[model samples]
Target: MNLSLFILLSLFGTILSALIAFISAKGQGHRAVMILLALSTGVGALSSALFLLSGQTQLIVLQSAWLFGTPFVFTTLSALFFFLLNTVACLASVYAIKYVEQYAEIYNVRILDALMAIFVFGMQGVLLSGTPFGFLFFWEVMSLSSFFLVMADKEAASVRSALFYLIMTHLGAGAILAGFMILSGESNFESFTRLAVLAQNLPPATLFGVFLLFLFGFGSKAGLVPFHVWLPEAHPQAPSHISALMSGVMLKMALYGFLVMVFGVLPAAGTTASLIVIALGLLSALYGVIYAVLERDVKRVLAFSSIENMGIIFTMVGVAMFTQAQGLSDFSHVAIGAALLFAVAHAFFKSGLFLGAGVMVHAAHSRSLEVMGGIAKRMPAFSGAMLVLALSAAALPPFSAFMAEWVFIQNIVSNLATMQPLVQGVLVLVLAMMALVGGLALFAMVKFFGIGFLAEPRSEHVAHAHAPELTISLPIYLLAACSVAIGLCAPWILKTMHFAELTNTVQWHTDFALTNTTLNPFALFALLLVVFGLVFIARRASSNIQNERSYHTWDCGQPITSGMEYTATAFSAPIRFFSHMITRTKKQVIATPVLATNKWIASRTFSLGLRQIWYDGLYVPIQNTCLWISTQVRKIQNGVIQFYIALIFIALVVTLTIAL
Candidate 1:
């Protein structure tokens, strides 16, 4: 079968399954449709992978010219994204067997089934779109589907979060449309391919304007800092499986868009533009980690961490572009390769981590980390996965994240050493700050996995950890395994990555000596096992296990209580204290003091709340202005047919005046 047709048919299959699911609303029928949904996604994913590997896939016209000869093209880039989307969507479907069924009682099974299929279909369309007009159209469709998915819960917070996500994304869509129109104006032709050829005629200033517009539009969707207000709310609002897809795969689609539009089409790398992107990236990385560190909600912490990782990738891309423009293509290759690797690694580990978080939330029935502690004993499999994911997120040695971060930093350091004095200094500072961000990320992850799962259970429910079904656990296990494999075999993976080919440039290989600086996961895991074996042998030889006495946590010679343990809030206290001046933390407390003694135990209670810098700084002001304008407009629409007639007459007069 033709690859494009097969892919489209796969999507059609999803729609078919959805329709079937809707028709079969009860018992045996619903079961059959659910099976069909999984089968469709599986076949679709397989087809996408096949197309990605095949060289025959090209721009195949499924219909006539779309918006002026802009027909769909099956490029390697678009195919790669489809490969990712379908693969994850397939896995999520397998997972949904158990995950979605749990909520079947509360939600209409038909609605979940159809929306799930439509959501996958929409994402595929977004990735496969061949023209700017088509892409934007599919982008909105994808957002609309996801918005409905988010709103599926229909709880108060879910509704609010869904609305916030919908509004923010729509605003981003407007910017994106404007940018595409600007790009279209520069082109006599309208197709993506034609636009690329026509882009050469565009003035540099106009190109830069379009670039900035895209940066805001795509960056907002990718949850870059200063534009990441909706992510925390939206992720928590969705089902765990959907959260996995969103955090794992959906955001990458936005990144793919930015790369295809800006770097892929523009074909020029300018210094000022690179610096702006780099500066924005650095700020985002810093801001994201700071907020993640202070977050007590487990899912929100992971969500903010996604922003941080995206920031890191963006910074690497910026550095690469700067170097490439400066004629240091070797350094540029390394930088860009590292950024892509990071994205791939992040997709695996972050999704695994999110799934682990979902399992914890499901078992504990809460999002607060303070209420969840020491599930390691009860939920070993879930905790084990969480630990590995946490280690990867922290960029520890032998994880894929470590390899990516190392390469990224090396590229940054190499570029800084070779660049002009001012650029070098600024880049050096950015790299230093990035290193700090990595450290803070480690701190945050430790708090998330350790304080949340390592210590004694803080709440009664958490004390008895429940394991989710194998369907949910299997995907997490598979991704976790991939994370380890990719880290260990990064050199081999790099060869297959075809990094230089993406830019249509000469391939630059990494030096084996440099690659040797990082230890592979196989070696790290082996070393750990050996160390653990030696400890076990030593303890066995000493026969000291029987003599060991169980004791409460040492609390300065006093009895240890749950409150005395390091709560999530207390664990993040240092970051909150340091970042308060910038990120701005809010605390609410009520205290009653009988006397002014410093040692006195006063009756007191406290709570913590956080707000994003962008919310207070940008979005609110714009929202207020929009509200004011709407209010003024609302005054014009009084409940009167005569008033409407008068308005129509005024409009006719205005039209006549303009025509005259």
Candidate 2:
């Protein structure tokens, strides 16, 4: 009946289904287990929404000495995050029905199903945990389980990506653990409820340190810049539904953690900390977008764009914090509330878009956008879903993403009027960066749609590939529908999202009514429909009036080849070239022409590969250093048992002498 009970039941259901799935390791056991798991998640989402919207202080507390602290507490925020978690889990569960068929051929379906259940449960624990300690325990559980999931493929690249993800996430967890410990020290208390007291007692420096720690820890998870290296590798390597969950919900879990820890717990965080956050956010937004615009790997492009969005959300939060510190609680609430709404909107559209991309990839047998075209005609459902998703992602008018971005930018502009001169200068940069990222995002989305869906097929494989299964397309459609609904009815939805309470900005009015102009998203949608209808009619009329003939795609009467078509790499080439100073694209061309009797008969080909900043910048040097270090350390692991015993005895003697 209560939210806590609902969450526990959902987790329990996963565990039960996992066991059943394991027991019935043959036949249709995986499907059955997945169905039950999906049902539990659906129930969890529904109940969580009920709990959060109920607006009652439904505290589910229990004192436990399992760790160094007492753990217990659940409020509206935890409920909100759990709702998101379960919703995504349910969608992903259904998707796995067909998505995991590729894996089932290699691994036991039952084992994978069991792991999937455990993975969802671990995420629930992370979201539902009341105390920092409880949160950490579940965080590790989530990370470890996810690590195993990433390594499920065990291909060389899979192994590498999984290893990178594991190391980075655990490193992030360590920082989070340290942050919690520091906050715990300041509190001199073990309970999350007592965090407010610690916030009041701790000095500014300690608060700032804790903030940075949490930033690195959770920012890594959220795939914020500098800490975002693991995401591009991890997301692309994981299975599709897993990628959807990771990008959509798991990243948001970290974001929820950051917000809960900072805004919920640290009541004393002020201007300086907020400014630092905003500055970092601006950099992330700029950097993420620039790289995203240049990426040819479709999933990687999406992944980088996520960094851009997260940066925008963080910037909004920073503005909210800054405004709150300046005693403008009304503006602060408006800003932070808008950011939270954006987070939700982003989750809906991004998940749907990624899943849609997954469907396309499966159908086309390629992740390269260059190879795909005319898919909108081939797979209408998937293409339409992707179109809506891409539009939303571009922050087009009336879409939920647009509404959120508008609210955020409006809040920033409003604050510029009253901010200090120095703060005003930074606000300019933030607003400008947001604008720039939005434009780049538009370009990127256009590229995705134009190259991958609308034009004629660029390759034989894509021309011949069929539509994705209904199972894949259906979930994406549902999510895209939610995006449209939310966009069309934003004001009504914002009424329920009480941002004022979250930021402790009680002075802000919860009734966010717009003045000066009517903002009707429904009107915008209708207008778009009409405009498109007229265009379609005109095109139809022209086809009847004019010569309507199809021919080879203006190839100058030369025989066409896949290379002659616009490749994804070539499409992004202009941006890549422009941003070469930043993106550092490395190009290699191998031109070996086919020859007949010592005369060149055919022109050679050109191949392109993008440079990884991390590889040349960090990984290669670290790898080489480690190799060199290993060579030195190899002397110690000599194949002699007697020598090893002697070395251990010598170390023991050294320890004894040191103790003496």
Candidate 3:
């Protein structure tokens, strides 16, 4: 079947959907917009991509005119990315049906709906664009749309964030264009297929420069460390469903570009390149999770955690590259396959978690976890959906996150003893870091769920909160359930990807392929079910509602106070103490001594701030340098007539001399 026709139809449908959403009455169009978005972007695009991947119908999708000098193109790989982009977009559209209502009073919800639809279309445009101009054009469409979404609230902070995002994103775009230029050489408009051929003949130094350009270009968008200053600042500024879409679907655009560059457009990069990528990923993962642990803002915490997850996926890709360079296709396939699966898992759970955070923040009217508690008691169903998302983020068993991490670790562990010394040592470090990052992620989520949900109400807002309407909660449950379903379907996914064939001339098993360790999700599910059943039964038997009991929880039975329970800050005290230097945590002293004689004895006060290594150590210095240079340059425009005449005369003489 000719998939191009279907894809074209989907794009047409997306435009129509966006147009309708933009024109509809302010409060009457959100539902229709979402329905149209789900059909066009969600169903239309998804069906076309999946049909192409299924390979049953002859794919006229891949043809000669489809490749060389075309505005758009497709392959099995792009088709896979196309599938992922639409999957999350579909669910997110449905979720936005209710999430945007809170903004309807203060903003034009119809325009917001249209922008979101266009944003998805732009992202799809990035995947489809085969030419450099096409790609950059679509990239800006996506970026500009998101910038407006970030500023939709019209807050000063959000405007600053939007400008910062716009500036940084354009810088990266420039770098990408430069890399494209270098690869295409004399033929600036060469298609990617031709560029791959051209790259094979390039000098080693030139190729290395191209790689650096690409790393910065793509890494900034992917939120890799040292280039990730904008990510946390920008992601939380958007509406929550918009945040979900940005975090879940948009980041993968960078991944797609990076992969195509490394393995597709360019020839084999050496071992050093692979190692550099690995280090970058490791640093980002550690940095992101540490901040996630210490951060108190609900959305900001999720933003940092997104950095961590992105870092982990980058590391897996680096591992794949290293193995591929070393001529070990077995480990390479496993690493790459694991990376893709991990990304899929992250998209589902992170989107759900962001949407869930929106719900909590909407009810409490605050983003601070310090002010949120007892959410579970107030909105049990909402809490339940979020719980699944939290567990998935923590990488617990019988969920997508666990299975993704599991297969990577299992493959490495089972094969570690058989590898060479160098490979073995690197694997050991990677394995250890993954374990540590996983634990920290779990800690972050526990703090996220427990401090934000389970405890007694920390403020008045939470005390009388109610669950949101069905429009909001239903999408969350569905997304959260995917976290479980994807995990259960891991065996089949891996098999379909031919991970079994690539990793096993040794004939690896279905669960823990090519590994001796075999703990399947099915087994884990069985174990957790038994434990859950027993706990439920015990709670049922222990209850005695007939004999009602109540106790004073705060102020010696007088009243409840925010200070009565374990606050999020206090919960993270041990971590702060241990990693204060890394986190830039600080304390202050407040003197209130009894008298002049005892004035030396003073109480200490704390005011924690994150002086992140990247933002301060790198971006700030660059900013100051630029400002200093600008001042120096400004001196030239002194606005004097005599000086201008002399300068013009000198310039005319110099030009005549040069021309002669």
Q: What TM-score would each prediction reach against the true structure?
A: 0.89, 0.89, 0.90
lDDT of 1 at 546: 81
| Best model per lDDT | 3
Pitting candidate 2 against candidate 3, the one with the higher lDDT is 3
- TM-score of candidate 3 on Cα atoms, chains taken together: 0.90
> Model-by-model lDDT, in order?
0.78, 0.77, 0.82
Off by over 4 Å in 2: 1-4, 61-73, 186-189, 499-509, 513-517, 534-564, 587-607, 618-660
Question: What tens digits encode model 2's per-residue C-alpha lDDT throughout 1-660?
Answer: 556566667777977877887789473687788789999999888977877677664466444665565344556666777777888788888888887785576556766777778878778877667667678877887887778777666678877898999988998999988877777774544556567566667787888888888889998898877788888888877777877888888888888888878877776467888887887787778777877777767788788888888888888888878877877677777777677778888888888878877777776777777677778878776788888899999999879899887776766665578778866887787778888889989988988888788767776777776776677677888899888987887877677644324435343355443221266778888999999999999988777645566665677778666555566667777787778776775667565657766645666666566676765788679879989999999988889999999999999999999999
How far off is residue 66 in model 3, in Å? 12
Q: Which ten residues in a row have the lowest lDDT in candidate 2?
A: 508-517
Tens digit of per-residue lDDT, candidate 1, span 1-660: 676677767777878977877677453355566567667777767876676555443556365654455465666566666666776677777777777777776556677677777777777777766677778777887888888888777889989999999987998888888877776685443566566666677889988888888888988899887778899889878887788788888898888888877666675768888888888888888888888888888899999899899999898888877877778777777887787778888888888888778788877779999888878888788678778888989998778898888777765654465578766786777779888999999998989888888777788888776777898888888778777877888776665433324444444454522364564556777898899999999989988778889877667877665676798888888877777787677679988776777637677889778967688879889989999999999998889999999999999999999999
Residue pairs whose backbone atoms clash in candidate 2: none
Compared with the true structure, the alpha-carbon lDDT of candidate 1 equals 0.78
Model 3: per-residue lDDT, tens digit, 1-660? 556777777677777878998889875877888888877776654664566446432233333454344566665556667777887787788778877877777557878888888898898888888777678788989999998988888889999999999988999999999999998988866567778889889998999899989999999999988788899999998999899988988888898889878877777767888888899899889888888998899999999999999999999989988877888777877787788788889988999999898998987899999999999999998899899999999899889988888888888987889888888888899999998999899999999999999878887989989989787888799998889998877876666542222111222223336233466677778889999999999987899857857855446646666677888788888887888877885455455665667767766565655667777778889999999999998998999999989989999999999999
Clashing pairs in 3: none
